[model samples]
Target: MQARKTIIRLFTTFLQFDSDKAIGWVTDGRLRRNIVNSQVYSSEIENSENFWVTYWYKQWQDNPKSLAKEHLLAYLQETCYWVASKTVKNIYSPQYTVSDCFQMMIARTDKVLKGFKPEMGFGLKNYGSAIFSSELKELLRQEQEIDICTNWRLLRKLTQKRLTESLENIGMNSKIIERYILAWKCYQMLYTPTQRTGTRKLQKPTLQTWEAIAELYNNQRLKQLPTNTPECSPEIIEKWMVASAKAVRAYFYPSHISLNVPHGNSEASRELIDDLPGDEEKSPISQIVIQEEKLAREVQQDRIKSVLLTALEELDEESRKIIQLYYGAELSQQQIAKKLEMKQYNISRRLSKSREVLLYKLAAYCKESLHISLNPPVLDYISTLMKEWLKLKFNPPTSEMEN
Candidate 1:
């Protein structure tokens, strides 16, 4: 049997908090208590989730200092954890961790909330899941960049302010930091990696290279720092450089937070339970509920696809060609303009206008068929979804094309 969706329980369990602790995080205790007790986080009770989301969001907007803000954030964090867990799915490495991506999603909550409109008919979790997925992709890109960079390349890329802050974070005194920075400057000036290729795999400086760097540092320290500062040995310079690289790496990587503990508390965390709320057994009713949800999702997806297909068919030939060239052929605006004998800006304008028209149709479909309200946020979200769908629909795989 398929397992019941336990997103809420998973959230609370990862938080290492019980319903009481969760309630304590909120100012409006009564509402939170009602939610926890009723377990309205299930698919059947989705409207309950929507209500609390809009209610707490309003509280936050009305008063930035409102205690209900905590509740609002916690609710959104549930969506973040859900998306992050699904995206990462136990695939951890030195470069990426679930907690790290979760942190990135949490960081984007403000931007996500700012762009969310409850009037749009989509639930907050649904909205947040899309943005969180994008943020995770960006995090992955950054991690990949850092992962591939050698220590030398990483340090070379880091700004002086970042280096200073990193050294300071490790409790280095200002004077020592200054000496380290001066040594680094001398090394940068003197030590050049002999092997120059496209790869980031720069080998460590040889002993002779380190000695040259030390000689330069010794000669320049008197000019750069306090006149009486002692000259450093090659070993000390090498040690400082290695330590600086370590500091940069430590500062760049996301801090590992324990999922089993609540934020800001050091006490022992609560343990997970075997049974989720409201569904103890694989009963026929539970199975029916799950199937209904699955069916509803399929229905909604089909409706969206139908609306998009009709809208595309109704578009003008030129607009259709523009979309096909841009999304299907994956051509740049300039390239499309060149091939079509039009100005680049004209191609850009046509693409924008085409998107707007398609988005408007989708928004109308949402109102007429899906019973969703028309709002700027809703239109923006529909635009994102429409663009993604168009890209996927237009851009079939090479093998499929060949067939």
Candidate 2:
């Protein structure tokens, strides 16, 4: 079963649990009476009834009970309520998908029909209900958030401070070429995602901020920002250094990049559509074909990520630090080398060797798990194969598999 389908089935079962099965305590039932010594009292008694436990044990157990009755008393009432509440929530929550609805409906039909499908009607005819034909229309709607932004002035103040701090940190030592990337990191939070950028709530930044950042970068390129030996406020610089690092930190957080492959989607998608670097006048179908090919390429990249994480686990602290400081931390080769107190050349050599070893490990795992030979290890082909494997799992075969 597909994971989603299995989850739906389990959730549906929770929704439709019998009251008897869900209630964990005998006292939770409709009947409640005190069976006292020599007097079968039909009186409703609270759990505080005297020596009720000993009386129940004597009457109910065939022998000495396995569990101490005292041990269960504290939890029995609470457990029954919890179980019943959980069942109710699981069945009716909107979080339950159509697959859950299908399971519940089928189960209800089975019980009432007694070994006959609701569709078959169990040797009954003319039981058909009236059918209505209408145009497809959407009914569900709710109030939406208005497209007004908040805290505009406060946001601008933060952005100004952030830009200044970033400049102070990267002064003299920073590569001028990476100024665009620096500007992007500082204001990344400001820009809405592509899907939401069209929405009116997220205000676009004025050209002034971009122009200011560009002008500063140009001055730095012309040897005009701060000098290595300039008189400075060491305290202010330190604070800015921390702030700048934090801004960079946001870009490299694990949650940003570790998106799961969608249920009908996968992380194997590529940025191939960014440029569309081929014949521009091609048919739409050809472009789609190109996208499909791009989707296939990410499977291997995903595999590479898995292999790298495993390799990092097996390495010493120093090596693991280098791997993350290079990859997950998104530090450039020179930056990582400076952080680690190693030569840039050495960093390059280590990264190259790690890549070779890690790819070999992934190839071995592929062969072991799926019997895939992966001749010459074409990454794009591997990605395609992974997609096909996923499709095969959910798309049941029309014909029997050959033994």
Candidate 3:
């Protein structure tokens, strides 16, 4: 448990993956390859351009069947303890603690990475053991600062150096060591947030692409509504037809418009809502695939409109129409009331109530779209910012992280 805690802390800082969103990104293989190597016991070995001149180089033409790359890697993992023992022998320190074991890997350690190249059975000279001095470390540090944080493996040695020093200060007190390790785990958990799946700043191509997607989705939605189930009554059909119309209407006036386009709402916004599949006719068990396909389509389309429309679908058609006319069509409350043959005050009351429903929907939408858990205020801020982000490209003024 103590080890786990410290490791968690190490992961938090190393990968910045505290949230589920962060976890999803990491697990999905969307993270930097360096993290796997430097952060965890990564299996991959990256050979640089002058890889032969630096470390991890190998001389071709030797006993080729000696050690396979896969075998060598497996051996490294399986024999780290033995390696630690060998280091201890070289260093001649008993009670040296785990820090010394890692230090062995860091410096004053030498080993022949035995590996054989297949096909020709050539003898390979593996240079697995080498130490970096402070000067070398400085060079490494400079390289990291110049590079993006994606190459986190380069940062691990540095992180470990400090952590090892910190660990050494605590002496060998078991309780103290346990406490510190626990703290480390908590630290890792805290640092991890949402990971960047794609580029952060919204660009013109992305917006235009989304706009095109919205149109395609609108057609698919129209096709899907009637195909979902057996025929139903006029009342049910009316409910769906009016709700769909309202959603279409509401889509016109987005709460926040994408900034990439000089004209925010000049281009048409597509409606992408489908009437709920006939739940009454549904089997006792649900078809997850069908639902997933629908959800995936929703995600692919103008995700923003999909989110708002989803909320609009939950309310009665009358309320939905009123809300749509009020916000979507930019209709005055009095005008909406007059068109619907209702009192102006009633229109106001319904719009307010529908707004609450839509707000909840927007919150859920943000969670799905950004993979960020946000409360009302945070959701509002994110929604607003995303709209602003949409208007600009990932260039000097808008881009925060320099690629």
Q: Where does candidate 1 have its weakest 10-residue lDDT segment? A: 274-283
TM, every model: 0.48, 0.21, 0.21
Query: Candidate 1, residues 1-403: lDDT per residue as tens digits?
Result: 1111332321232232232122112122333343454344344544443334544566566665543344555566555655565556533354454556666677566777777755444456656776777777766765677678888776666678888988998899999999999988887887676776445776788889889999999988878899889988999998998899888767555564433333344564332221112221111124344445545655676777887899899989999999999978878899899999999999999899888888888888889977877777667688766765775588632221000
lDDT of 3 by residue, 1-403 (tens): 0111222122212111121111211111111222233323312222211221111122112222322122222222212323343344443335433233433332222223322211111112112311112212343334334243221221122343344344444343544333333333322333232445332221222333334433443344345433442433324322332332233223221122211113325454321111111111111122243334334543533565566556667889999677556544547888898899999999989877876666666666656755656756565444433322222212112112111
Report the number of clashing residue pairs per model. Answer: 0, 3, 18
Query: In candidate 3, how many clashes are counted?
Result: 18
224 in model 2: Cα distance from truth in Å?
59
State residue 364's C-alpha deviation in candidate 2, in Å.
0.3
Q: Which scores greater on TM-score, model 1 or model 3?
A: 1
> After TM-score superposition, what is the CA distance of residue 16 in candidate 1 from its true location, in Å?
9.2
Q: Assess each prediction's global lDDT (C-alpha) against the native.
A: 0.64, 0.33, 0.34
Candidates in order: C-alpha RMSD to true structure? 12.2, 28.6, 33.7
Candidate 2, superposed: residue stretches over 4 Å from native: 1-308, 377-403
Clashes of 2: 3
